[model samples]
Target: MSGSGSRTAAARAAVGAVWSSVTSACWRHWPTWAGWAAGGFSLLYGLLGLYWTAGGDGFPFAPVDPARASGSILEGSRVEVVAPIIAVLGLVGAVVAWLMTRRARPGRRSAAALMVFGWAAAIGLTVIVPDYTLIILVAFAPLLLVFAFTGVPGDQGGIGDILYWHRTNLIIVFVGGLLWATATLAYRRRARGACASCGRRHEEGGGPSRQTLLRWGRWAVAVACLAPLPYEITRIAWYLGHPLGVTPDFLRMMQDTPGMLEVGLGCALASALGGVLTHGLVARWGETYPRWIWFKAGRRVPPTLAIVPASIVAVTIIPAGLMFLWTSEARGTWAMYVPSLFWTVWGVALGVATIAYHLRRRGACRHCGQGPQPGPEPRTSLDQRQVRDDPVSAPGQRA
Candidate 1:
């Protein structure tokens, strides 16, 4: 029994060691090689586009039923027209991303062009090429897990419908976009004579100060918080049979529809939760965990804890929110989609807020030997307090 326990312990130790090494590698290398990753993804995606153009059966969007395609930006699109263009752009993007990967000798013209291409591709892939399917899918993930066991309700064909290839394609695009954006940011920093890791200029006066980001971050947080309120109100109103945006009959129909009201209520709740979390961007508890939970109480919150999810939601929802506005235009039901219109703003503001939060809290960069370089005095007492107690500043030691 003693021998067996020793062996088990050894095995566990080996597994833990291997896992730790793998995670450490990923953490260190992923962002560093993000440009290469983007190039690879863009190249592959472009190839896929070419395949679709060559009459692949699994073309996602175009050639779907007219009823389904009616309200989308790609409504009247054709495989022949769109696929080749997408392929060309993807190939171009791949090349641009590749070039931007390493800045061995930076020429202003070359850097400017590459920057434009990289940023454009990043924004387009994240914000334009996809739709609300990504955000909605993420939001409804819990329900999807349940549906997997119990099956989806109503005419909504099983889990396959929600997790369809087309929707999954949006996720893929979203991932590529994230890679591109990360790559572009790094490339931009390096090109502009700034630290690639922390995005701070090494000059006399560095990039935007912590205080500046905090002040603007609060404004961004406010916008992010408010943007979702309209949607939440309308969704809850519809759920409660009030029909704030639509007709009474429409509300009744929605209520009558299997799981519709429930979904609406879920969305409203999610929106409310989003607003609460967005507030956390500027909140004390956001930077440091409150003394409420059992574990990690009063600990400095990991920056990635706030950044990753917020960034995902922020970028994914732009297209999702715009879907409502575009669909309303196609169907001529502006009032019905009014609440969702602000989702675009919500996404953009949340993105800005997330960036600000990151900027404010990112204590140091190992690559650039950059600590949060101090600059001008904060405008407000609150800013002073927050800056003084910044987790990046003191780590476990609170000021």
Candidate 2:
């Protein structure tokens, strides 16, 4: 029995060693793995899309009807022919990314080129196959439920329908813009070790009072985030048969789609959670991870992680709000105008808040090693009196 137990222990130790070695190797070469995986997937999907398109059977890309205004751009010709070209580009990107990973550190030119091409492919794919693209705003399904329950004639019927309409080329433009901004920042960081915008390191300065701006900005963001909660709540109540903002007929229709209620509740909860997260922008937690997050606690937050998403949300909301205004006026639903107006305000406020947060936390110059300079000391009452009395000593004294 002792001999058998010793053999089992040895086997377990060998297995553990092997697993650790494999994991370590994978961790060290993650960029190569990611690049290969992305390349393979893109190539496969593009080929499949092209093959199906040639067969006269629409298996991948959505069939476009020549009659519709939106479909006209893709009608009569296989516009999806670009899929294979994009896939080839993706493969090239993969090679570049792999090369970058192999080097001690990726060069700025290589990284920038890879980022530009990768983002272009991603945006192009999204634009070409929007129906297959996952919608981030699906979380707002509950809010849409509210409109549906209220028997709003302009309500686009279901969340899916709304997403179909919302995922336009405009989204691609915004995402591309964000990708450019992030790539520029990454390149600057890797190349110069200085702030991308200011050229100098961000350091604490006594130049101006930003406390009031930050305080007000945080509150504004919180309010803006929570603004959609009322609609969400009413929608949830309607789902539960309380019928707050809904008609009896609408309630009956809602009962047919019981799952929608759960979805709406989830969205409402998510929105509330988002409101809570907005506070992190101005709070200490934004600068450093909270204690509850054990692994990353006290670690400084990556600025791009917060700024990119916030900026994207802000940009998307502005156009969406404008669209809402136009649609509401055309449909004569004056009440809908309020949400549109508020959405624009929210977008602007969130953008300002994000900028404020960045300004507050941006580090001092890594290049010149310059930090915030001390302001000149203010004169006290006694010092002011003495200076006034001693004129020769105060100004241009001839010694």
Candidate 3:
């Protein structure tokens, strides 16, 4: 009985040690813990809102009668069905966020699972609430102007008009972006710490010198970045009563709409701004903060800060560009075909530039601004034997 009691005590002690370690780690990284808690709470709130909507009660902020709620062809009752699915997703996301906080590196499996879930939520919500999705996409890529202007059936409203009325979907898009960004950042952090060749902890090095490929990559990025300018200019001209390459009927239709000119002008300005930002990827300011910024001037830029958003944009735009290419080819619009090709090229170029930047910056040691220096070689057995046998003949000895 005494031996069994001792064994139980030992087990309890081991579990206590583990718990202490976890608590200590959590205390040290309290911000990460707080973020997880916030995410969980937000998800719970979303689920609650959905539940309230599903139960024939109006949402707290925006009340609508249950009979007036939109019905879904696939599920019969949109609120009743989608709310439960989203609630399940939210629960899973909350659990995953908690698990991520417990470890320094969530394994590849966890990262993959999180990515899958994030994308699923993003896509599902986009399909169900397209207006919100359109707005989010527009914010990211103004080139989506074509789709935004397309008319929706039975509503006598353009896609933009319908989206304007359904503003609640913005919350869903925001949550989806958060989930995806978190998962992606976690995965990138793990990847950065490990060596690509041996999967070992990488010591700092002056990586590859600036090569021809890198120079070409910079130029490609510049060209691709500026490619959107022509499309923007054409649209602006069309809106301003100087039609360029567009039919008179189309221009007339656009001119009749309120704020259409303003929208085109906004898209043009946004494209120009995006082009300027893209140049920073290959510029000196990309490595060291520009002097214009008082606080962060001369400070080294974090690689992930640039890489993450660029990666997301590349991933999204590449597929969209491909679809545009297919549709433009079918319609035989050479003007559209040329501009759509630029989008795909821009995505590819941005990705390449980001990779080059990472490679250039990743080699410096955090402690020293230089690559890892070679350590002194240890004496081999042969050298040791030689020194022992003839100390006088050893290097630095006078015979």
Give candidate 2's TM-score. 0.46
Q: Which has the greatest TM-score? A: 1
lDDT per residue for candidate 2 within 156-189, as digits (tens), equals 4554454343244334434443443443343334
lDDT of 3 at 247: 69
Poorest 10 consecutive residues of model 2 by lDDT? 66-75
Total backbone collisions for each predicted model: 0, 5, 0
Across 1-399, the per-residue lDDT of candidate 1 in tens digits comes to: 999999999999999999999997876655578999999998997898899899986666665654343233665578898889879988998899888877586899999988888888887878777777788777878888999999988777788866666667777887888898889888888887887776766674655776678778889998888887877888787777786767777778888888888887888898898888888887877876665764765556788999999987897788887877556452444435776778899889998999889877786576776776544433334344455765443345444
**C-alpha positional error of residue 30 in candidate 2 after TM-score superposition, expressed in Å:** 24
Better of 1 and 2 by TM-score: 1
TM-scores of all models? 0.85, 0.46, 0.51
Model 1 alpha-carbon drift over 4 Å, by segment? 1-17, 66-72, 148-157, 204-206, 294-297, 329-335, 372-399
C-alpha lDDT of all candidate models, in order = 0.78, 0.52, 0.55
Off by over 4 Å in 2: 1-168, 176-196, 199-210, 295-299, 328-341, 365-399
Q: The CA-based lDDT of model 1 is what? A: 0.78
Q: Candidate 1 has what TM-score? A: 0.85
Model 3 lDDT-worst window of ten: 67-76
